[model samples]
Target: MAMTAGVLALVLCVLCFAGFWLGRQEAVRIRSGGVQPHSLPSYYGSYVALVCGIPASLALLIWISAADSLVRQFVIAGLPDHLSALPEGDLALLLTDVRNMAYGRVPLNTARPEIVGAVEHYLRLGEISRWLMWLVVLALAIGGLLLGRRMVSAEFRARNAVEQILNILLIASSTVAVLTTIAIVLSLIFEALRFFAKVPVTEFLFGLTWSPQTALRAEQVGASGAFGAVPLITGTMLISVIAMLVAVPTGLMAAVYMSEFMPGRLRAVVKPVLEILAGIPTVVYGFFAALTVAPLVRDAGMAIGLNVASQSALAAGVVMGIMIIPFVSSLSDDVLNAVPNSLREGSYGLGATQAETIKLVLLPAALPGIVASVILAFSRALGETMIVVMAAGLAANITINPLDAVTTVTVHIAALLVGDQEFDSAKTLSAFALGLLLFVVTLTLNVIAQRVVKKYREQYE
Candidate 1:
């Protein structure tokens, strides 16, 4: 795949350069004759480049999509009768092993005589297919370049042609986004429906326990699949609340201090250092939460005569909050700065103190954006997985106590889909249902944020 892509890119670049030079030469000669072309020479050149690049790109995309499957089918058809007579699943695995051997993923020489011969055949077919793809794509690019070069004339509307192609590219980009969103929603809904077929919706929504372990075999022990999700929902909300509790006050205060009181030199240095927290990986936070914070919390609880779980949600939530502090602080600071200096000056002109001016004028003006930052931080809290996994153990207890170990929806989804399993099984399908729920929750938060922004934002002239 990588080799084919590089070759196709080189071909497209060469053809684009050829078409650009040809059209530019034609435009220059006409301009030298004291006749203005319909558009700039550069626009004509761009038009030619687009003509050469677009068709070749589309052909290359089509070839890459189809060639692998076509090659696989051909190889499968020519397999030995005994291998082909294997069950469908086994046969599929056999073919994959043969291909792996051909690609050096497996030892090539240890295979049976039949498998050895088949590996050679698969390699030969792959080589032929790649060569064929390169030929067809390059031919299309050269053909487009020649056609575009012949069509460039003094009266040609190169600008209009370029604009039309630009519009097409924009429409294609928009269509891909729309189609991708629709596909994801449809896929989730489809799998959730499959899950609902085996497990009652009421059970999943209202049941207190969430045990999604179904035995693949009837003879297996301890396979009672309880698909309750309320505990997971409760844990998610608890963690989010803890995170927001920690982030909102501290982040907003930091933003207020930076915007209203701190010196410019100190603010500049502190701001980036604070934002460095956001760039650190969640896995790193997970480690800090588990190795450092969890122990601290446990020790603190013991010192204060309180019981704390080994893996407490408080530890996860606090670290997660610290991780998302920049999200709130940075946005709130920008919004605070966005409040017109005129408002502050007017307040000061009325003999108000600086603190009063901030409290009375700036805070209200920046409230909408501050609210958005908090909501965003909450959403980030709810979506966190690694921190929860490492610090808040996967014990789905429906409790609001921060010191208790609890698991969130994302952790459960990851657990359900960690290893190979049948997609049609209710246990696996539950992940899609959990995903749909998470999507709705995030969507609701965004909608509420938008409504608040629209209604309450302070408009400035």
Candidate 2:
């Protein structure tokens, strides 16, 4: 079946390529006759290729989804009535075992006659389906090419037709991504609903305690599980707040220095180094937070006559902030740079000092982008896992102090599913609940950032 699918894909690819070549040749032939049209020759080629490829690709996708079920039904129909009466899922599993046996991997119960017959039928149906698909695809491609060729006349508006088709194609491509996002959100929602069924939704949302271990057996003593998410949420918010405190001022200042103040040579040398901060792995940042930053923060706090845990929220948040500085600075710098030089010149022309001009004019003009960058950085900080895990303790404490150790949603989720837990257990289900929360938070931040950036663009343009 894999071989047949591969061959069909390869044949379709060749036909599409041929259609592109033919379309281009026809466009060039018409152009050589001094009859220029709306679009370039490549657009015509793309249009032909798209027409020849899209329908066949869609058909192949549908066939791949349904072919196994169709084959299994046919094979099952020929089996004994008793065997056919099994549950759908059970019958499907049995058919899967038969296919495995046919491929000589393993025998399903020593290869009974029924299984052997089903396997034989499966292979026969697969071969027939492949042939039929190939014929249909070839005919479609040939028909599309012939139609395109007939349409390529002296007065034909191939360019407009091609562009309109391309517009639809682009929209279709974008819709796939949008739909995939919707599907992911829906899946998370259902999993979270399952978790809320086991644990009360209000408790998950508002309760302060977060121990997820429940009694395994009915007779277990003193094993009531707490599902309060307040601690995890508190830790997440605290860490993100500390990270933003460190990142926002530093990043904005850096962007200001680079975009408005720095000389060209220094800017050239510094921008790449700043960007290199972004390329460093988060796991490496985890190690840096654990081994270097946490100890330093503890020592510094002790020197200042304050009590601090060895693994503190301050250390993790600060390090994560450093990791995200590049994201904020680089994006802010680009947006600042994009602010028209004429605006700056106009400000300078009014005898405004560079400092005053930047503070009153440039910063206000670039405010939306800077806000977007900060929101983006906040989202990154919230989603960070490794740094917090390595540098902060797993204790879910409802504290506001950065010097105290705390657990975060991501760390809790990681701890829950690190090795293996039963899928139906509350512990495992809690991970999905946390994942749903994380997804929603990040998605909300992204939506707001996009809106801000769009408004900024509109304001300036």
Clashing pairs in 2: none
Model 1 lDDT-worst window of ten: 215-224
Leading candidate by TM-score: 1
Cα RMSD (Å) between model 2 and the true structure? 4.8
For candidate 2, give the lDDT: 0.85
lDDT per residue as tens, model 1, 1-461: 76867867896898899889888888898899999999999888888888888999998888888888888788878888887788877788888898899889999878899998889888999899888888888888888888888778888999999999999999999999999999999999999998899898999999998888752533344444888999999999998898888888889999999999999999999999999999999999999999999999999999999999999989999999899899999999999999999999999999999989888889999999999999998889989999999999899999989999999999989988877566767788899999998988998999999899989987887
Clashing pairs in 1: none
Q: Locate the minimum summed-lDDT window of 10 residues in model 2.
A: 215-224
